[model samples]
Target: MAAKTYSAQHFVECDQCEENPAQYFCKNCPGQLCKECKTEHKNRKITKNHEITELNTKNEAFFGPLFCTDHKTKQIQCFCVHCKIPLCTECIIESHNGHAIQKLTKAYKEIQDDLQKKKEKIEEDLLPKYAMLLKTENLKQSDFSKQAQEIEKEIKAHTRQLVRIVKQVGKNATEDFQAKLHKGLQRIVDSEVEIQRKIEKLKQTKDLLSAKIETKPTVSSFEPVNERLLDEFEKLPVLPKYHFSKFQPGKIESMIEKNFGKLPILKIDTAKPNEGDSDIDSQEEEVEEEESDSEVPYNLRLVQESRRF
Candidate 1:
């Protein structure tokens, strides 16, 4: 729309007509590369490397210049489909000379057609597979949620039961120890009372014996005490730790095949239509014709691979 303006000292670059034209003509991809720049653009090592589109033309630039690797000066205008490289007419007499050389324009169109077929195939075949994958994942997630919830509930209930058992075991052990403590305390109390009575009798008898005269020795003492009895209560067994299974990552065996095996195709029978449905019949015929014409027969890719003889 708006023309490029330049200062009086310097001239504006023209993209279409000429260097410093009266009016700016058209634009290319990036910052306006002028028409004068086209020669420089084509000659540069990096710019020559790029698929540079001309600003003035509708033709999209693909695969730069298509120059013959053998013939440096020549633009490769013909593609030897057998050799699959661009070749000038002069190269025809060389080793691969006799092979088929289709014009580059036809080759380009043929490639475009092949790519279109591939794109459509991806939509027809792989797209449905992708959608099916999504559907399967969603369904599986729902099922897993339901089942995992049930499993978690079961695990929680079992865990609570185990905890109750552990608590009961602990309570029983504590109560048993307390009962043993009661017996030990009673035994110690009875022993202390017996000793006290013996001491009091000895004190009275000793006072009398001292009043009479002094005698030789005395009786021995007992060994087992309340501390020894409590040691028996201290030797109770300990409770064990709780364990659980972890959730692993991967598709379950049964679920794997259902998601991955195949893309489904629907069966349909074409019925002959009467005069009233002739329009539908014509459309179907046209579609079939287009489909047949548009199919990609075969071609090698840009990448190379080993071929079978």
Candidate 2:
């Protein structure tokens, strides 16, 4: 039933009682109080001096108005430009006498306008750019992964091809080595057979001379036979010479490059974009301009910043 007392707005429960619709706002305690709790709150020694006002009349408190801390009866009418604080009539006569003053309403309007413009800039300009950037980055990441997979497949295929080529090369080299070895061995074997035949012939001649000497043969006959054997021995063909196959190793690095091709190096671009082209910097500059032009006080700045989240 107490909610009917409030204007056309959401009903709020008293901060103290939590059961009744709030009808009053305590400036000093900064609490919402219902009509029933307001009397008790005022009776309390700690809250008795607090400035309490009807909720409907306290609308300006939610905006940018404040009662002076020095003179509790007077509302802030001016802003001390130098100190960047809300000023009451008493504040102007005291410490802020010579300080640059601006109307509190003007300052509040300027802060509100600046905040609105920043909000519009974020929504219209920065948010869309960031969203597009996010999309592009996601696509780029996917593309990079796809390209890497493709390159990996190619590398694997090349490696298999190189393996097959190397196997064939090794097989061919082995076959060639075997052929040359056989040829060298065959030459040595042929020379051995020829030398063995000549040895047998020389043995037969030696036996015949021994038998003729045993029968007391003349010296003239033996001399001719011995001379012939000596001539045959001297004329015997020199052992056939052969050079065997030997393997000469090549450079491994050169072989790898020649067979499989050089592996690609990983390159990364870590260089940042131009400062002027940076969106973050541009947004920061805009925020700085908003702060400078509005000359928002600390509390108002806090309020503006809280709205961003």
Candidate 3:
């Protein structure tokens, strides 16, 4: 049997190829290549100048499922700069045609760059405005609380004043009623004493005659008089029922409204966009779908605004 000699090339791995066709990940390649295949692949004019490194996608996070502007059925694998419409490579010749289109990864990075700048602007300007709004809300709440306290105190004082008036009127009526009651009692006592004295004298005179004598009541003793005096002293009125219905806090009412008016609404003002704001608007940017490559794409998505009432 003859001994076979093995070549060094057999042991060495292939160095150049495409990383993934699904991702359109031509990491500088025309077909699928592992980390070893990167060196031996045919270096094209465009890809020779392009950068390739170890799969360090840990930093490069992504979001997708983008749509093709022209085909509508084709998913957006790439973005055309001049046309500003995303398209798949199959539509690149038919839809994008001759226009320059870059991979969606590059486009995403461009968006990220704008996003980073916008984040800084939000920290410096936009976030502070939110903080200011919170502070304004707090101040308004404090003012409202103060107004509520004042109103409460004023109402208490008003109640006390009305009560005092009722008490004063009741005291005067009670004093008059007491004076009339005392006079009525004294008149009744004097009449009882006069009747006793008269009866004693009649009995003494009748005993001396020793004859049968019929006693007759005198008309003067039961004379009708002063019925109005007894009616006046009856003192039967619901004294506290009458009260001041209209409470006046007229001065304090204005202050209460003033406190409530501290809260203001959002006004219409032209805010200048930061350097990357146009890019944020672009993310919301719409691409028109057409029948073929001949038509122009028109954007129609309007940015929504948030309003505070």
Candidate 4:
């Protein structure tokens, strides 16, 4: 069997021996060394107490800038809490003198804990409250839309009723004017008939008187005819003067328009905090009375106007 031969495949050769595979890395010396050379490197006065790590152990200190920029030879090992900056021994002593400082590892853990608490607050409390508010606002929006639709329906109904009322008023006015004109004209026609009868009697009387004067040629005949004429004239009826003023549509239109303009405003009536059932019932009764009173005019006026017409 062939003896196992040592080879440096993944790792480099020791910096001192250049023969054996490196087993440890010195952070202060900043180099890899074999076990034999590592012992020798540790015993040296200049390298003694230098931080050393195994080759397999991943150390971030060896991968990046460890020395402070201002103090070229000093390592950056501490974090300044007050200034919120990384610092070395010299930086702490000079610029960040007496400032609250901790080891970088400890500071990093504390910062991570604080960030976790903030994340929990956002996820558990703040975000859920905002979500509830958003939900409430959405519900309010839906309610508002429903209310708007209801108001639109009410407005349409009121407009239709107003139009009906205006039409009825116009029809009533026309019928009333026609009725009054018919009544007046009838009275005039009756008076004219009576006057015509009287005129016929007067014509007969004049013819009789003219015949008497031609036959008798006496003043006594004149006296009898004159008396008859005077009596007939007294019995005759004087013709009546009938006058019908033109219907003023503007006045009726304005009145109907004013009534329509008084339509109630639509609104949401919130329940009173202290109101009881009795109060609510009273309010309902008042509303009923108002509605009944409002309808009275339409009923009574329409009936009365129809009768008059």
- Tell me the TM-score of each prediction against the true structure: 0.34, 0.40, 0.30, 0.36
What is the per-residue lDDT of model 3 for residues 1-309, given as tens digits with 9 covering 90 to 100? 232344431222223321221212233332324444344332655555544443322222122334454566765576677755556767787756888877665654554444444444444543454344334335534553454445444445533443333233223323333343334334334434443443344344323222111111111111222324223212221111001112243232332221111111111112222223343333221112234453331110000110110
Displacement of residue 33 (Cα, Å) in model 3 is 16
- Give, for candidate 2, the lowest lDDT window spanning 10 residues: 215-224
**Cα displacement (Å) at residue 169, model 4:** 17
How well does candidate 3 match the true structure in TM-score terms? 0.30
Clashes of each: 1, 0, 8, 0
Tens-digit lDDT track of model 2 for 1-309: 344344543356689977767778887777788898999999999889988887752255432235676788887776777776777888899888999987654554544444444445445644454344344445544554454455445445444443444434443334434454444445445645555555555556544434443221111211222223334544324332223212333333455323333222222222122332343433211001123566665323433443444
Which model, 1 or 4, shows the larger lDDT? 4
Per-model CA lDDT versus the true structure: 0.37, 0.50, 0.35, 0.49
Q: Mind giving the per-residue lDDT tens digits that candidate 4 earns over 83-168?
A: 76667788988899989887665554454444444445445644454344344335544554454445344434444554555555
Better of 3 and 4 by TM-score: 4
Q: Give the lDDT of residue 261 in candidate 1.
A: 15
Write the candidate numbers in order of decreasing TM-score.
2, 4, 1, 3
Q: What is the lDDT of residue 251 in candidate 3?
A: 33
| C-alpha RMSD between model 3 and the true structure | 49.3
Candidate 2: stretches off by over 4 Å: 1-65, 70-74, 164-254, 269-309
Q: What tens-digit string does per-residue lDDT give for candidate 1 at 178-290?
A: 34334433433453454345435434533433322211111000111122322322222111111112222222243321221111111112323222334354322111112
Prediction 4 TM-score vs. true: 0.36
